[model samples]
Structures are given as structure tokens and as C-alpha cells.
Target: MTDRAALQHRLEQGIATLGLQLPAGAVPRLLDYLDLLVRWNAAYNLTAVRDPAEMVTRHLLDSLAILPYVTGSTLADLGTGPGLPGIVLAIAAPGRAITLVDSNGKKVRFLREAIRSLKLEGVQAVQSRVEDVQGQFDCITARAFATLADMLGWGGHLLAPGGCWLAMKGRRPDDELEALPPGFALASMHSLAVPGLEGERHLAVIRHAGAAAAPAAC
Candidate 1:
């Protein structure tokens, strides 16, 4: 069994080191998610990383690293596999309603269970092609979904007016930015310093120049 107290302390330390201050109640929720992820991974193969310590450092903490820059009321996660940043964002920002979108049925299944088992409110999992979904959101996020161009092509429509896309990329997305179709401008880029992780990570915040529409068109 996982040591709950140890997990809580680790999460606390991770956030603190990253210069993030989360609410006191977020710890239990984080612990609950870590537990569920471990249990479900055994059956669903949701993730390859099975060690709880590594998961805290890699998945949960890494996801939370982008939380400080996410600006939105309701967020949409494109190609969410087992709800990385989406579920973590929902838990971190309790008031933000998050919709987790994925094309894989198995991943969506795991996402549904994660949402249910964690009793995560304001979180809905949708199994659909990212470009086919129709809904305007305050923010759109994708982690390791695809190349920046493809991700933006599919998920760009989901952004609401005056909203932005928080695409987490490893290195600077210069080539991907060049491939962007139109009406999008680079807003800001945040170099992520994930606690206990090596190498460089970044969160590219891109904004639309014109009005935003639903994700029905690529």
C-alpha cells in the first residue's frame, strides 16, 4: 500500500519548491488521484510509469507546474490520455470546469473511471476526435498530443474569444508556430521548472487574433 502521509508531504514539497501555493485541501485530492492512477494502470495500461514516487514527480507535479499560467473559466483538454493536465488542472483549480477529450476508447474509459473514482465534479470526459468536437472554451491544453501545428489545427477552434491555448512543449515550437494557419499570435512562453525533473520544459501560451469558434473546423 502507498504511504498516504508520505505522498502528501511529497506533493506539498514539490509544489513549494516550484513556487506554487495550493489550497490545503488539494493534498487529499492529489493522493486520491495518485492511488486511482496506480490501481487503474494495472488493468488499462494508462501510463508506463508505475512508481508512485516517479508519478508524483513526473505526472502530477509536472502537470501542476503549468497551473500558474493557465487562464480560463472552463478549459478543454485535447487528446487527453488518462487526464494528465486536465484532471490535475481541475483539482488544482476547483472552480474551473474541465472537459477531457480523447480519441482512444481505452484512455477515455480510464478517464471516466478516474473522474468517477475521484468524485471529480465539473469534469466531463468526451471520446471524440479533437477537431470534431464543438464547444468554445476559455482555454485549450494538450500534453504530448501531437506536433504544435496539428494540435493547434485541431484544438484551435475550441478557444473562446479573448482566450488562449496552453500547449506544453518540450523545446521552443518555432517550426510549429510557423505552420500555424492564421489568426493566432504567440502570447507568452513560460519555461517550466518541474520539481525533481531533469531537462527543459516549456508552456507556450498562444492567443487568437480574431474571434474564437467551436472545434468543428481544423
Candidate 2:
């Protein structure tokens, strides 16, 4: 059985560490999502991380680490397995139209159930390869999805003008940065310090090369 009290305490602490201002009732809803993930993971193997306690930091806190950098009115999380930051973001931030995209049928099934169970009004789950997904978004996020070049190559067209693509990676991908498909440029890169997470994590912010340059994110 999962330790609900311990997980809640830990999640609360992690949110505090991230300095996030989540909407009311967001915490309980996050735990609900986590529970759903845990139950579904038991049979489907949706995520590699198995332990519910470990998931508090690895899955939940790790995703919340990027909350500060998320901007714009609409967001899409490509390759969102079991809703990672997508469901987490929809719960915490609220109001933004969020789409969780993944090519795997089982994963997308989990996402649709998550949205329905969580009562996430504006969130959606799309089953498609990133390249085939339609419509532009003000913000795009791809976590552990693909190399910078490949992600941009497949989904770069979905980034609306003046929008940003937040690519989550481990080490700074210097080589991949150079290979970004012709029009995208690195606006900023922020090193993320996720509570209780080991190793380095980086979020690369990219925009159209023609857009006015913005200062590096801290």
C-alpha cells in the first residue's frame, strides 16, 4: 500500500522548495493523479519508476521544477508519458489549455483517463507522432523525448511566433544545440534543481531565430 500521508507531506515540501503558488485543491488533485498513475502502472508498466514514494520526487517534483519557466496561454507536452508535467501543470497552474501528446496507445489511454478522472476541463490527450500533430501552441514542452535537433525537426512548426519550446534534458546539449533545424535559436538555458533529485537537469528555451533575443534564464 502507498503511504498517502508521507507522500502528501513530501509533495508539499517539494512544492514549497520549488516556490510554487498552486491553486486551491491542486494538492489533493495531484495526489489523485499520482494514485491513478500508481494503480495503472501496476499492470501497464507506464513508467520506469515503480515505487510510489520515489515517484514523489522523481516524477512529481522533477516536473514541477520547470513551473517558473512555463509561459503563454496554450501549452503542449509532446511525448508526455502518463502526463508527467502535462497533467501536473494543468492541475497546479489551471486555466491554460494543455495538450498531452504521445504516440503510445497505452500511455495516451492513461492520459485520457487522467484528464477525465481529474476533471481537467481544458486538457486533452492526443495519440500521434509529434510530427503529425496539428495546430500551433504558445508554449511547447518535450521532456526526455528526443534530441534537440530531432524534436525541433518534428515539432518545431507547432511553435507559434513569439512562443517558446522548453526542452528538458539532463546535461547541457551543446552539440544538439548546433544542429537545431535552421530557424530555431537558443533563447536561454536554465539549470533546474529539483528537490530530492540527483544529477544535473537543464531546460533549454528555444525560439525562432528571427525573434528578438531574450536574456538567459536563471
Candidate 3:
């Protein structure tokens, strides 16, 4: 099989392992997105994950692992370098308004092209630092972007009332969670298992301190 075809097989297996029900045509488009990233990374150095097969496990599957936790109509992916979970989420579950934010011009440029090429409606790419970007969103996602305090401190204002913030991390961020600025509280925490990924993965669900409480995830 060709390299891309092999990558497709790996992704299929990973999704199956995750027991996800993706919208139709998502898998193909995801592969197409991977193809785009491979081409662009040659020049822009988008991601350190240089291998396509590994990206299927590390990037695609890792992003999809958070799909179950992502809720709401509008989402802002802060510091979304080359649209990690942002683009991946947009492709997997259609119809959500997704804003892919990045300070790097090259990354945002690639994101715009991906949004256009993939025909992803309601998805926009913004080239700006997290602190300067404006607009509230129902769901916020940051993948290994920064410490919880820094991320919440910079982009916390963008989180709408009753909305949730999803922080993807390598392991349980005990120290960072404790250091979360006032007005933000942990809603729930989930351990994520990505097929073929060796290291630990965790998702921190946080909500505004004043928001109404809800039942925690099972």
C-alpha cells in the first residue's frame, strides 16, 4: 500500500478503537487534510511530527479523543498550530462554528487553505496572539498550548457564560490545575487512550466558577 493508504488504514483502526461515530465522509477528508499538512510542512515546518503514519496516531487520533468531551455550537481553538484539534474536530463533527487561532502567520495561512480546500463551512482561521483575539465561544480547546494559568489568563475572557474549556495535556496537570486563576474551576477530568500512542493523555474540563453546575462525565 502507498504511504497515504497505510496512513488511512491506521486511522481507521484508531477510530474503531476509540468507538467513535463520525459524520459521513469525515475519514476521507481527514486523510485529505493530512495530505495537505504533509505538503506544507516541507517548507513551513508546521509540526515536529515528521512522519505521516505517526501523525495518524499522535495528531489525528489524539484530537479525536476529545470529540466526546467537546460541546456547544461555537468553539475557539487557542494556539491551534496547524489546526490540531480544531481542524480535526471540524472535520469529524460538522456544523460547529470553529475558530482556529494561531500567532504564526504560516500556520494560519495553512489553516485557511485547509478550511477552504476541505469546504469546511463556519470554520475561520485567525492570525493573532491569543490575548488579542476577541469573541466569545461556547467551547474552548487548547492542545499542549500552555499552562492552564497562562491559557486561562490570556484567552479566558473569550469563554462564554456556561461554556466549558477543554485543555489537552500529556498527563494529569496537578500543579497547573491547582494554579488555575480564580473564577475558573475544574468541571471534570478524563484520561484519554489513543490507539498506538505510548504516553499518557488527559483532558481537563473546566467551567466558570459562577456557572451552573452539571453532572460530571462518567
Candidate 4:
């Protein structure tokens, strides 16, 4: 088998073994994405992991672990570095509209190429900081992006009245939770069991109450 085929096999086995439910059709697209990531990293340095096997285990499965907790018709990825759960979620949830935002122009350009190469629909990558972007979204996500407090402060205005913030973190951020403003409430905190990832992974689902309750303060 070729490298991609082996990677696919590992991904399939890993998902099945981990008992994670993934869109059946997304596997191929993910393989294509991994291939592109590896190629682009040579010039753009999109990710540190170069091995396809490691990408399948670390990046792909780790991203998919959040699949169960996300709820929204549309989603935006804040600080979408190389499209980590954003692109993965877009593939896993094809029906949802996904917009990936990033400050790095090179990364944004890579995201656009990945979208096109993967044949992903309803996905767009924009090169802009979260503060500069306009319009609210049904859901927003950040994976290893910022502190809960900072993400809340920056992403607060972007959430639709009843939208959610899906923040992926390594350890439980108790302090960040305590520091959160009043308007947003903790919807749920799902501990993720990612295949091949040995450390802690938690997906925090936060709901926006209103600006009155939790004023967007710097």
C-alpha cells in the first residue's frame, strides 16, 4: 500500500478502536488534507508533525474527538492555525457552514488551498484577526488558541445570541472558567479520549447569554 493508504487504514482502525463516530465519507478528504499539509509544510511550515502516521493519530483523531459536543448550524474557527478542528469539523459535519479565521496570511492561503484540494463545500478561510471580523456565528471554536478569558473577550461579540464557544484545551482550565464574564455559562465539558493521544484533552462548550450579563471588556 502507498503512504496515504496506510494512513487511511490507521485512521479507520483508530476511529473504530476508539469508538468515535465519524462521517463515513470524510476519511478520504482527510487523507487528501494530510497529504496537502505535508507538502505545504515544506514551504509554509503549517504544522510540526511531518509523518503521515503521526498526523493521522495526533491531528486527525484529536480534532475528531470534538465531534460529539459541537452544536451549531454555522461555525467559525478563531485562530484557525492550519485548520485544526475547523477543517476537520467541516469534513465531519459537511452540512454545517465553516469559516476559518487566522491572522497569518500564509496559513490562510494554505487553508484555502486545502479547502479546494479536498473539495470541501461551505468552507472559507479568511486572513483576519478575530477582532476585525464582523457578523456573529452560530458557533465558534478555538483549539490551543488562547486563554478562555482572552478567547471570550475577543470572541464574545462574534457569537450569535444563543451560540456556543467550543474551546479545546489540554488540561482542565478551572481558573479560566472562574474568570469568565457573567453572560456566558458553561454548557458542558466533555473529556475527550483521542486515539493515540496519551495526554489530557477536554472540549469545553460555553453558551453566550448576552452582552449585558457578560460585557465584552478588554
How should the candidates be ordered by TM-score, best one leading?
3, 2, 1, 4
Deviation (Å) of 13 in candidate 3 = 0.7
Candidate 2 TM-score to native: 0.96
- TM-score for candidate 4, please give it: 0.91
lDDT of 2 by residue, 109-144 (tens): 999988988899899999999999999998999997
lDDT (Cα atoms) of all candidates against the true structure? 0.84, 0.90, 0.93, 0.84
lDDT of 3 by residue, 54-128 (tens): 889999999999998888899999999999999999999989899999999999999999999999999999999
Ranking 1 against 2 by lDDT, winner: 2
Candidate 3 Cα RMSD (Å): 1.3
What tens-digit string does per-residue lDDT give for candidate 4 at 135-179? 888888899788988888887889887777888999988888998
TM-score of 1: 0.91
Q: What lDDT is reached at residue 71 by model 4?
A: 71
Query: What is the per-residue lDDT of model 1 for residues 99-194, given as tens digits with 9 covering 90 to 100?
Result: 999999998988888888878889999999998999898888889679877887877888888787888988877788788768787777778889
Model 3 has how many clashing residue pairs? Answer: 0
Candidate 1 runs further than 4 Å off: 210-218
Best by lDDT, which number? 3
Candidate 2 overall Cα lDDT vs. reference? 0.90
Which parts of model 3 have CA positions greater than 4 angstroms off? 215-218
- Model 4 C-alpha RMSD vs. true structure (Å) is 4.3
- Backbone steric clashes in candidate 4, count: 1
User: Which candidate leads in TM-score?
Assistant: 3
